[model samples]
Every structure is written in structure tokens, then in C-alpha cells.
Target: METISIRAPSTPSSATKARRSARTRLPAAIALLPTALVVLVVYIGCMLWTVRLSFTSSTLLPKLDWFGLTQYMRLFANDRFVTSAENIVIFGVLFISGCLIIGFLMAVFIDQNVRGEGLFRTVFLYPYSMSFVVTGVAWQWFLNPGLGLQKLVRDMGFESFTFDWLVNQRMAIYTIVIAGLWHGSGLTMAIMLAGLRGVDKDLWKAAKVDGIPTWRVYTSVVLPLLRPMVVTATVLLATGVVKLYDLVVAMTLGGPGIATEVPAKFVMDHLFERNNIGLGTAAATIMLITVVIVLAPWVYARYVRPQGRHA
Candidate 1:
């Protein structure tokens, strides 16, 4: 056979170099300028200012008077601060897990070729669409004993029914949690549904041929494949947990004597209401440290490290 040799087309190195030089001068720099400006103007700016204030005896006006670690010491000793830390841990664990489990179940049920698919999706996602201000009030009313659950149950002739968690000091925090779950699970469901839709349809067909129980296919096979989405959902939930304030404020008012008090609420109360900037910054610093400690490893594995084989 007559030999035929085809030369691979190649661009000149000068052209390649010019393109690379252009990337550095224009598109890449344009892409990065906003991010760099944002980091400086917002993220790093707040972080430095916060840390600086933490070391100061600043009050309402954020004065520049230095006062070592007195605020940190006071923060460590404050019973409310201690309790807030404990509550955050409890809330973080319960809220993240509850949202994921319930959200996953809801997503699965909704994905089952159900009736009123759009209506059901809208109903589930409406919480995400609506502001927490309204949702918190609605949940508060629903949880209130005299106005809502207890009264309704009593009216239905179960006179002894007492769902009074909303008022009880010890039980009220969980009420915030319940409302938090209700408000957040919708977002979680949406994320998981997107994940499910992206899953290979062939997996289901293979599972059927092998007679694998659907639940087993999910728990054993599918769930493992969904690590990325779960991580994304958890991070979203975790950040919300760290910034948990409005829900506590609107629903409970951090009331029943600060029983449902959260760190973010504590920060806001000090920073704006109580005029205690140093203490507020201390709390914020602690929260920031906590988030870093808990999240740094996962973030490194997910984003920083070499991508591991999914299977």
C-alpha cells in the first residue's frame, strides 16, 4: 500500500505566546479584578476590621483602644456565650441531618412520577422563594399553643393535647429548629432533585435487571454517588447555621429569657442593640474559627486536593 503521511497542523509559538499574553492582559485580569476587589473590599476587609476590634475595648462606635484578650476571656466566661456555643453545636448537627434526611425523602417521593408535579414542586420550593420574615411568623403562630396547635387539637375534642413547646424555655429552641427545618428542607430537596436528575438513567435499569431493592440501590449505590451534592447541601446548611439569627429573632425573640439565643443573635444584640462591639467581634471571631475548623478539611478535600476517582 502506498504510504500516506499527514502532518498535524500546528500554530506558531509566537501566536500561542500572543494569546497567552492577551489572556494575562485582558480576559483573565478582567475575570479576576471583581473577585480581588470583592475579597479586599468585603471579605478581607471585614475580617481584618473584626480581628482588630476583637483586641480593642470598642463599644458602639468601634473605637481603636487596645485591650489585649480581655474580651475573649470574658466571652469564654459568659454563661450565655457558653450556652450559645452549645446550642450552635446541637442546632448544627440536628438541622443539617434533619434537612438532609427529610429533604432527600421528599425529593424521592416527588420524583416518583407523581400527580401535580409542578404544584408539588412549587409548594415545596415556595418556602425557599419566600422571605424568612413571613415564614417565621407563620411558624410561630402554628407552634403557639393558645393560638395554634393546642387550641386546634383541643377544639377537635382532644382536650388534653398540649403542644406548648413554643412557650417553654427548654423546649422552645427545638421549635426554632423545627421551623428551621421546614424553611430549609425545600432548598435541600431542590438540590437533591437536581442531583437525582443528573444521575445516570442506566443505573436504574441495571438495578432492576439485578433485582436490587430500590432502597438498597439508593442507600448503597446511589447515595455514595451523591457525595458532591450532599457536601454542597451541607455547606449551605452549615453557613446558614453559623448565621442563624432571623429565625430565632422572629419566632422566639431569643425569648423565654435567652433560652433559644444563638451566636449570630448574640453578635447582633451586642453589635447593634447593646453597643458592645468588642464583645460582638469576639463572638464573631469565635464563630469564624469554628467554621474554619469544621469546614477546612472538607473544603480542602473537595476543592483543593487532586480529584479522587468517584467510584
Candidate 2:
């Protein structure tokens, strides 16, 4: 057989192609420059400033006196700070799990050819649109022994009824968890509902053909496919957990002898009210460190790993 030599068509040189691509991308980058500048000036600038303040002996205003890690040492020794850390972990785990579970159930129920889907969806999602300030007040009222659950229960002739978790020092944090679940579960449900809707109807048909149970199909099949949405929910919940402040302040005021105190509240109180900005910044630093430590591994696993295609 004679070897056939085929001449390739002429192509642009690498430098010429690179220049052309850069010309196209230059306008897009120019458009994005304003947004980049805003983020650098605002978010990143404030974060650096906050980190700087954490190392200073500031009080009532931002002062810049080198205090080393003295504030952090004080923070580590404080029992209130320790308690706040503990409460945050408990609240975070409970709030996230409660929201996901309840939200999944609600979403699944609503997804079933139910009557009045819009009304049910609205009823659940309306809570997400409302301010936490309002939610906290409603929860406080509902949990109050004299005016809410206990009073109602007692009036029903069960005079010895006692459902005063909001008053108990050990249980007040749980009340916050309950309120947080109520506030967040609605959003979770909406997310899960959207995920459920996007799932292939073919999967359900195949599952039914194979005589697989509906519940198993959900837990094993649909839920696995919804992993991205679940991850989204978890990250959102974790951020909210870190920023837990207004809810606790509104619900319990961190009262009953600092029974339900959380890290955010601890930071806010000392920063503004107690006039101990140094110590407050120290607490804030600890919170930031904790977040970095907890999230770093997950971030690395999720974003910094090489993908492996299956055989």
C-alpha cells in the first residue's frame, strides 16, 4: 500500500490565537473589575481590619495597641466563653439535623400529588421571608410558661402540667434549637422540594418495576442524587449557626444567668456593652479559628481533589 501524505490546513500561530482570546476576554475582565474592587475594598478589607483588631487592646472604639495573644489567653480562661462554644456546637448539630429531617419529610409529603401544594409551600416558606426578630418574639411567647404551652396545658385540667423548658437553665438552649428549626426548616423544605422535582421520573418507574419500596427509593436513590442540594443546605445552616445572635437575643436575651449564651452574643456583649473590645475580639478570633479548623478539611476534600472517572 502506498503511504498517503496529507498536508494539514493552515492554522493561526499560538501567539496570534492567545492574543485573539485575550482581546475577547479583556472586555469581560474590565466589566468584572468594578465588582472585584468592591469585594476587595469592602468584604476583604473589613475581614483584615477585624483580624487586626483582635490583636489590639481596643475598648469602646477601635484602638491599635499591641496586646499580643493576651486577650485570647483571657478568652480561653473564661467559663462563659467555654459555655458559649459548647452551646454553639450542640445547637449547630441539632438545628441542622432537625431542619434537614423535618424539611425532607415535608417536601416528600407535599410532592405526593397533594391538594393545595401552593398553599402548603407558601405556609412553610413564609417563615423564611420574615425577620428573625419577629420569629424570636413569637417563639418566646409560645415557650413562656405563664402565657403559652404550660398555661394552656394546665387550663385543660392537667393542672400539674409543666412544659417550661424556656425557663430551665439546661433546657433554654434547646428552646433556641426549636426556634431555629422552625425558622430554617422551611427553606430546607423548599430546597428539597426543588431537588425532588428535578429528579428523573424514570427512576421512580424503574424502582416500582423492581418492586423496591417507595421509602427505600427515596432514601437510597433520590436522596443520593440530591447530595448537592443537601451539601448546599448544610453549608447554609453552618453559616447561620456561626452567626447565631439575633435569635438568641430576641428569644431568651441570653438570660436566666447566661444559660443560653452563644459565641456571637458573647462577642457582641463584650464588644459594645461591657466595653471590653479586646476580649470580644479575642472571642471572635477563636470563633474564626474554630470555623477554619472545622471547615478546612471539608473544603479541601470538596474543592481541592482530583476527579477519578469510574470504569
- Candidate 2 residue lDDT tens string, 1-311: 01111112223469887677667666766777787787888977877788888899998888998989888888889988888999999999999999999999999999996999999999998888878888899999999999999999999999999999999998999999999999999999999999999999999999999999999999999999999989999999899999999999999998777889999999999988999888987888788889999999897787556432221
Error of 1 at 168 (Å): 1.1
Candidate 1, 33-72: lDDT as tens digits: 6877887879989998998899999987989988999999
Clashing residue pairs in candidate 2 are: none
Q: Give the TM-score of candidate 2.
A: 0.91
Clashes by residue pair, model 1:
none
lDDT of 2 at 16: 85
Candidate lDDT scores, in order, read 0.85, 0.88
Ten-residue region with minimum lDDT total, candidate 2: 1-10
TM-score of each: 0.89, 0.91
| lDDT, model 2 | 0.88
- For each of the candidates, the C-alpha root-mean-square deviation to the true structure, in angstroms, is 7.2, 7.3
Candidate 1 — which residues are off by over 4 angstroms?
1-27, 307-311
